[model samples]
Target chain A: MISRLRTALIYVVLGLGALVMVAPFLWMFTTSFRPVAEAFTLPPRWLPGLDSSLESYRRLLASDVPIGRFFWNSTVLATTVTLGYVATTTIAGYAFARLRFPFKNALFALLLVSLMVPIQTTLVPLFLLMRWLGLVDSQWSIIVPGLTGAFAPGMSGVFGIFLMRQFFLTLPKELFEAARVDNAGHFRTFWSIAVPLAGPQIAALSVIIFTMTWNDYFMPLIFLNSVDQMVLPVGIMSIRDPVGNSSATSEVIAAVSLSILPVLLVFLVAQRWIIDSFVRAGVKG
Target chain B: MTSIANDAAAGWFSPQNRKETIAGLLFIAPALIGFAVFVAGPMAATVVLSLMKYDLFSNPSFVGLANFEAMLDDRRLWKVLGNTAFFAVFAVAGNVGLGVVLAVLLNRNMSKTVQYAYRAAYFFPSLVGLIFVAVIWQFLFQRDIGVINYYLGLVGIEPVRWLSSARNALWSVIILDIWKNVGFAMLIATAGLQSISKDYYDAARVDGSSSLRTFWQITLPLLSPTILFLLTMNTIGAFKVFESIVVLTNGGPGDASRSLVMYIYEQGFKSFNMGYASAISLLLLTITVIVTAIQFALSKRWAFYE
Candidate 1:
């Protein structure tokens, strides 16, 4: 009976911490549905009236803020980065794990060292290069930098490569060997055999890429300057300055809610596999 | 047999070897090119740019160490550096501490339903954007109508200026960061905890060791690698903190909560001082490298990698 009480107490304790953990989310979700002034009200309304429920969202969508355009930009940018990252990392990582090439280990070591350097060091130069190339204020500037490299702003290329390599290493060597013995080229074997078996790993990689790209603020904030070019994070910032007048809070909250929901859905549905993939990759922030 | 042995010895470009080399290079070419342009090329350019004053609007002019020398007289730079360090040390400690504690609690024999629920709640913030995190918290930290102040009222404490007061501003940033990141740290710790075999705990139980004693002696040593990993990543993340500060404080009530990266952005973009920004970023890079190197070196004594 004492043990049962202890378990009950532990549950209460754990549940309290979880409440703190999810408080902002709860607040955001609740606030997103109400009028701006309702947020500052004393007891904090948890349930909105049916009329106020979609008021903030409608205000944001219909406002001159161009939020819908931002969402489209984010979607296109994220999808392209995901596809580019998946294609590049899968092939490169596969070669690192399964093929014997000159200076292969050295190249992988170089990738590891590349991860250690922070992006701040490269920011000025990348900006300069983009300006020199006349790509500044273009979406391509944001996309190109994130599309490749070990420390892309959209996602970590080194992590993706390492994940794919680790996954590839687990597949039987004979699968590739069998194809090779039949006079198949590496690409042919990789396409016809290896890629088919790596569905879960690819999905994990794509999920990570998509989410990271969707939330990427730094690259877009720096590389793209136009209102039309704005991605969600930066676009929303333009819409709602932190110390804006009292009337802006609910709309900002609504914008934030819409921005996060897609990634939240992905997280909620795939929490298990996502966490496992992160742990397996020994993820870095 | 002799001919075959000679062929093996002489063939540096055997058909299979050539095929392997060609295919491997072809496969990895995009990654290699990307590394060159984005990472290696920029790194090299950062060094050169630090020695030249080339604002985006101006023609390039060579400056001989003037930017680095200017660092000696820069008051704001020093202040922001100190601010970043304070933020890094506390935020990393708070994150890793909360993460480990939560990980340990969840690792206890518990119902699966409760376990999954708590895990998702903690991890949900990590999925949200940092900018959104600041937006959400900005409401909660509002002095008059804010739920935080409302709760503090019940506890008999006065409402504190969370993001506006210089003394309290950095702490607010740290708190916001720790809240968003604790879940991530917890997830990593949970992963580390799960990997630990059940046999060690069984042995500890049979030995009649107290739970605290078992935790210190067995669990801690075994978990050192994960802790070390958390320390390195969290420290680096804290050093690179940007969007949250941009949204929430904008370096704040004064220059109280400005970070190294924020300063770099201000100099490079705001003031158009590319040369000085490059110099400061090099400082940022050096400090991060030294700190992580120290962490790994220290881990040599305690980390129990399997």
Candidate 2:
């Protein structure tokens, strides 16, 4: 009888924990559908009324903030950045794992230390460099910098190198020897053998990089000059008049919804792998 | 340095080793160059800039001791530092504690679907941009029409002015910060939990130790490394909480929520006083490095790694 009661209590606690964990998201979805007047209605209307309109969507779409332009810019920038990181990280990771190199360990150590540098410290000099390049306000400013892989070259590429190296280290060394004996160059062998084996790690890194770049506000805020090039986060900043004097609730909700949905969709699609990657990275670290 | 010389000697002695050094450098070059220019270069500049008094218009005049001296005298610096410490302490404590509890509950022994569902739901906020997360929470914390106050009113409770009032705003921000990131910490904790051999739990069960006792004695010790890592990362993350605070309260209701980072932003960008801003940033950087080092040091005592 006691055991049964304990089980019931466990279920109750888990259920309540789940509710608290998910309530805010459910509230976000419901609140987005809520009419401006009803969004904050007493008793906190858990569900939007049938009359909750798409007027918020219309306002967000119609705002002078160039919402569409920002979305497009963010989408393009994030996509290219992810692709650039994935490509650079993959080829580099393969080399680190399989190829011979001088100062390899030292270079790897340097990269790891780079991760410790605070982002604020670098902002001024990077901004000055961007200004000097005549790239300030240009889309290339964010894009070019985003492409550069920071220290822990492999590891900081979301530790793509370490992960791939771990996996590589575990693989049969004979396969690479066979490829070399067959006169296949390093690139050729990597393309056929190593690349095929690296699918999961590549996917993991891509999702992580995509998420970080997409959600990044700092660089985009500093580098991108005009409304036309502002990414979603910065774009939202412009649209959001923190004073609450301008920009209605609907428009804000609409903007939030717009910014959120694409990444939300991505998360839903690869939820398991994303979770696994995070788990793996933490344990390995 | 010795290793480099050894590698060169070894490579020269063995013909096959010739290709290894070349390949290694080639492999690491892109990442090295990128890190150098983007991260390391700027960091070095920040240290230098911290010593000089420069606005954009003129040459940065050398004022080595003055800026650092001013930092010592600035009273607001202490308040902002205190505020940041409070934020890091509370947010890290709350989130890490909550995360360990949730991870324990959602261990591999739990229902698979339910675990996945909980993780997915909880991590939803983190996937979104910080600004969007803040915006969503803004409505939730609304004074008049906020979901929180509205719900409170339902229970015959007074409508709490959450973000608008200075008294509650910082804590309110802390609450939202915890909510957004607790899932991340939980995910990390979950990973650490999984790495432990199930044999340990099984052994404990055979020994007839209570589940709670086993968790305290075995699980906590096992998870300590991850806990330390999470604490360090979360502490850094909490200190860097600017964008969300900006979007949510704008350091509001006075300077109640003005974090060290936000204060630096105001000095550097808003006031355009490069030297003062650099001084504050240097202080911020010093605090970050010290705190991180302390966490790493604490790991020696508590963090049990196999």
Candidate 3:
């Protein structure tokens, strides 16, 4: 009887905590369906009942947000960045992991340190460089810089190479030896053998990069000046001018819901894979 | 012998292979060059610019540590730094505490499906960009029409101007930040919990230990490594807090929420005082490195990586 009581207590505490964790999102869901006036009704309407309407969604769709254009831009930009990152990081990661060359450790060290340097420090020089290349306000500026997988020699992604290298180092040397005996070159062995076997790491890296790029706002905010080029996060910012007198609460909530839902869905679908990768990597490597 | 000959013919060391190496470099060149120009080059520039005096258009003239001298004398700089430290400490502590509690709860074997759904819902806030989250919370905390006040009205509590008062604004921002990021800390901690073997719990039960006692004596001790690592990451992130402040409070009503990064952005971009801004950025970076180093040094005492 005591044990059962303890178990029930644990469940109650856990359930209450989980409710707090989920409350804001539930409030978001409730408010999105609520009319402007009804959003803050007495006693606080916590859920969407019969009176809940789709008006906010309609307003979001009908607003000057160009929600479709923003979505397209985000998709294209994220895809391009992810693909570019994969191609670059794979070769670079493999080289750092397996291949031998002069100053390899030194170069890799430089990359690691660069990863530590925050983006704010480099914004001015990067802006100037972009202006020099006449690439400011263009998609290429975002895509090209993003191609720098694991960040630059001096910031964010030096660890990318390290993570990938850890995985690569664990592969059996016998596979490489056998390939070499069969007259396969390094490149051929890498593609035919290593690449095919590296499905999990690739998936892990791709998902991480996709999520990073998807949630990125600062880079796009600084670079893309026009409405047509605005990504979802930045596009959403233009909805309510911070100084405007208009009540943009409902519209902004709809935009937030739209921006969040897709990524949340992706994360849900890939949660198992993500967790698996981390566990395997953390334990074995 | 045939394969050996082919290996020789393929010539891994041949002049042609050097060209292939160059091509490989070419394949990775875009990323490499971008990194060099944008990240490395700019960082070096920031360091150099910090030593000089420039206001955007004019060529920077080296002032030989004047920027640093100015930063030391600037009272506003110190205030912002204190605010940032306070924010980082509280926010990190709150998230870490909340994360551990949630992880412990979810670690149980029953009701796993409901737990997963709740985790997803919590993580949804983090999926949206910081600015968007700010927008939602801005309305939620508004003095008049906010749902928070609406609920408070029932309890006969007067509406509070959450973002208007100097004393309340910073705390409100911190609360928003804690809510935004607690889910992330929970995920990391939960992942750590999943890695722990069930044998630990079983052994404790065999020894006649209660569940709470088992958690305290076993689980928390074992989870120290993950907690340490996550604490370091969370502290660093909280120190760099910017967007939410920018959107919600704009470092007002009276510079209450003016964090170090916001100050850097304002000085650098808004006022175009590149030299002064670079100095502030350097100070912020120094604080980050110092704090991270201190954490690493102290982690040796408790972080239990096998």
DockQ per model, Cα: 0.63, 0.56, 0.38
Please state the CAPRI-style docking class of candidate 1. Answer: medium
TM-score attained by model 3: 0.89
- Quote each prediction's TM-score: 0.95, 0.93, 0.89
Candidate 3 C-alpha lDDT tens digits along A42-78: 5556678888888888877887679889889888988
Writing each residue's lDDT as its tens digit, candidate 1 over A1-285 gives: 986897789889888888888777877787777666655567775555564667788878778889989999999988888888888899998999888777889999888776678777789998888888899988888677556634546355787788888889999876876787687877998888989898888987888788888888888888889999999988888888555465576788888999989988888888877777766655322
lDDT by residue for model 3 (B114-197), tens: 766666655556555677667778877888767688878789999988988898888888888878877777777877887788
Model 2, chain B: what is the TM-score? 0.93
CA RMSD (A), model 3:
3.7
Worst 10 residues of 3 chain A by lDDT: A150-159
- In candidate 2, position B72 carries an lDDT of 83
lDDT over C-alpha atoms for residue B195 of model 3: 79
Clash counts for the predictions, in order:
0, 8, 6
Candidate 3 has which clashing residue pairs, if any?
A114-A154, A114-A155, A115-A154, A115-A155, A115-A156, A150-A157
Candidate 2 residue-wise lDDT, B155-271, digit = tens? 899989888787888898899888888888899999999889889988999999997899899999988898889888888778777877888788877788878888887777777
Ranking by TM-score: 1, 2, 3
How many clashes (backbone atoms < 3 Å, residues ≥3 apart in a chain or on different chains) does model 1 have?
Answer: 0
Candidate 1 lDDT over B1-306, as tens digits, reads 232121334443686367766888889888888888888898889988899897878787899899999998999999999999999999999999999888887888667777788888887788778887888887788787677888899999999888789988888888999889898888898878888899999999999998889889888888888998899989988889888777778898688888889999999999999988998989988977887888879888868976
